[model samples]
Target: MTVDVEDYFQVSAFEEHISRGSWDDLPCRVEQNVDRILEIFSDQGVKATFFYLGWVARRYPELVRRTRDEGHEIASHGWSHIRATEQTQEAFRQDVSRTKALLEDVTGDPVQGYRAASYSIGRNNLWALDVLQETGYRYSSSIYPIRHDLYGMPEAPRFAFYPVEGDLLEVPVTTLELAGQKFPCGGGGYFRLFPYHLSRWAIQRINQAEGQPAVFYFHPWEIDPDQPRQQNIGLKTRVRHYLNLKRTESRLKLLLKDFHWDRMDRVFLEPAPSP
Candidate 1:
């Protein structure tokens, strides 16, 4: 899955320096990076679900059309890259509604799924699920089952399940408890930072041992090492966002070759309706 189809300046860490009002003046980095991704996927004949930021969609309607033309699923990544937990219920509702409207306008397809910025729907903010359902989203891939400083639901179910009174399907990032600690087998920086062999093994183990399909995610920025860098952010956040970026495309190609991957929607079918 993808999030925030935007230039590097839109990332959460750099939000202070970059304002959304001035997005048009900045370079079209996401467009170039996404082109590279498209070429890579074309080489392998792989299709994916791209969760687009409404901001990106409004700015680059052609990119959204091209993604659909090339056979990728179009979904919402909210209008701005703002975290749902940070917004009031009314604000979150509007954020999602506006994004969904904009994405549908560009793709001419109903956007049934969403992923929050930073995967921000957690224990306290899970009320966003009901908001999503009310706003017409049927599925969400926003929860991260593993614990993290920004977002995680450590005790949440590892696989897809219907939360109480909610119609949305929850698909957390794939992770495994190795020696009793959560490991990042699901990709992103973890895929680049760790030995490639280890990621391959972890995915194999998850599939063969547990019979669960692994969910992998990467962003356009992840592959754009030459993109402008954000300075003065905390070291850990910067590293998490930028480390191994230069090698991301190559590593993605290797991972694609090593594993049998399908769009997340294909692997996990729609959940049953509640009684």
Candidate 2:
């Protein structure tokens, strides 16, 4: 139940091309969608974690306050949608720092966790983890243990494991190897693209068979059917984002009933030390 609080157009690669004006022109439904999510979770009596973007935190400060007041953990997702791997160490540090401060200002609570945009921390960007630790973050859910054009570290562990050199924890998104390929079970585009039962079964199998909890994530915009369509983007990005837009919310509600879900902090116990 780790929710990424960002608008659809705010994805990193498209940030340079998309303007703030574009956002104003865009249909705004994230707040409404989240209200619906709140209702669903309330009905189920579940509390979850929300990793909020500073941009979203600033504009929708009440939403942040409401989310925290409702017993959900509010964490940081950086100031802008900048990916950790693409920025210098200082730049990434500043982004996350600003995010932490802004979120705390809005919620009046400390934000101890983070999730990089697009799960962008990887082998070459291991330096980012050191920066994260120094910036007072206790854990990061930013690594994906699958190969992807945008982000992943294929050799990374599939569950919560502390890095030896830093205090920061690495809780990678859920991935399952199928047909000789590691597929992301992080439940974003993959969840929408695949059949509903397959996604549910994957998490169930992981939890029951492997004794590991599935870390699920989705953006506010993903479930918003009224979001604007981007122009001039590549075909894959469009399809990955905009496909089956209308079905996302209903499907997510259905998926919610199938599992015993909780925040990542509560679900992941600290790993045992190696010999």
Candidate 3:
């Protein structure tokens, strides 16, 4: 699962209390909070991976063609949310090649995946994963291997490897290791600061004790608890952007009925056939 389509005043903890030239005079609730997260992932059938934000897809091109005609998986959260360590590799290769050609010209498909605005491509800009595999992009949940004062790398590798030198795939976002440490059980703001049964027992111990598969993420202004709230920020960014914003859509419908989710290019760039 994933979402980060952006716009709680384009949050990078409200980029110094909101102001990318006042983000189009504020008050644009990411198209009614991504149409209530596409009606809670179509009432829990689940199929996510919506990294969006080429300035909210050039102002919601029919909410990215109704989240790609309701099946979901558009990907690419660059172009205006900056921070791939504040860009420079030719401005992060022209912000992921003009947000992957404006989200493949608004959903004609083929926009693989990318997610770096705020997971900021750590360890001194990992060449932004070779400019996301030389701008074709295959995978990148954008590294959040736990160690944060606003983004992490913490010596990377907590899952899906291949940091570079070929077939993309950086993955990272779900961490749970216990006694050896590494804590963030994926999903933004520690899935609203933990306690949804300890993030369903740390995603059922990363799926039955480390068999893997757990990326997870969240954003479309994190279930919009009456959004518009960023004045003079700092009580730890106002309790990490308003703590459990009205219990994040009932803990995301109990994390989509507690597990089995897809669409990071069909659980990491397709090809699971001939079973």
Specify the highest-TM-score model's number: 1
Off by over 4 Å in 2: 20-27, 178-180, 269-275
The TM-score ranking, best first, is 1, 2, 3
Off by over 4 Å in 1: 1-4, 270-275
Q: In candidate 1, what are the lDDT values of residues 1-275, reduced to their tens digit?
A: 34346668877767777787877787878988888888888788888888889888887899899988988888889988998888999999999999999989887888888889988988998889999999998789888888777788888877777874856788777888878777667877787788788888888898899987787888888889888776677887788888888788888899888877666566665334333
Each model's C-alpha lDDT?
Answer: 0.81, 0.82, 0.84
| Candidate 2 similarity to native, TM-score | 0.92
lDDT of 1: 0.81
**Deviation from native of the Cα of residue 85 in model 3, angstroms:** 11
Clashing pairs in 1: none
TM-score winner between 2 and 3, please give it: 2
**TM-score of each candidate?**
0.93, 0.92, 0.32
Give the alpha carbon lDDT tens digit for every residue of 1-275 in model 2: 88888877787656767876677676667788778788878887777889988888898999999999989989998877778877998899899999999988888887889999888888988888888899988889988989888888988888888864756788888987777677777688898898888888888888888888888988777877777677888887778888887888888888778787887666653343332
Query: Model 2, residue 229: what's the lDDT?
Result: 74
lDDT of 3 by residue, 91-151 (tens): 8899889989988988888898888888888888788788889889888888888888888
